[model samples]
Target: MQSNHDGKKPGLPEIVEILAVSVCFTYISGGEAVGAVGLLIAYATLRWGRS
Candidate 1:
């Protein structure tokens, strides 16, 4: 089983992953929607993890 531990920090890998998914979601468009969704996802994950 996985240990109950969190990552040391949000690094380049996390950012790259967010960007990759955002790009996939907004494939042919470039706008704040992608940024908002990405940030929303990040925030949601953070809050969810703590709770």
Candidate 2:
């Protein structure tokens, strides 16, 4: 069966938004390393959801 999605990848704006939020949380939590890991997980989740 074929999917109905347009197959368009996420744009720069979406990525920037994710990065901005991640950095903000990192600053708030005072742990750059943990924040970076969380960012990667969040980005991966977003990509997986899109696909």
Best by TM-score: 2
Error of 1 at 23 (Å): 0.6
Residue 14 in model 1: shift from native, Å? 0.9
User: All models: lDDT?
Assistant: 0.59, 0.67
Alpha-carbon RMSD to native, per candidate: 4.8, 5.5
* Native-to-model Cα distance after best TM-score fit, residue 45 in candidate 1, in Å: 2.4
| lDDT tens readout by residue for model 2, 1-51 | 433435666567657867786777677768777877677677757754736
Model 2 clashing-pair count: 0
Model 1 C-alpha lDDT per residue in residues 1-51, reported as the tens digit of each score:
443337555557666766676665565445568666876577648743533
Tell me how candidate 1 scores on lDDT.
0.59
**TM-scores for every candidate against the unseen true structure:** 0.43, 0.48
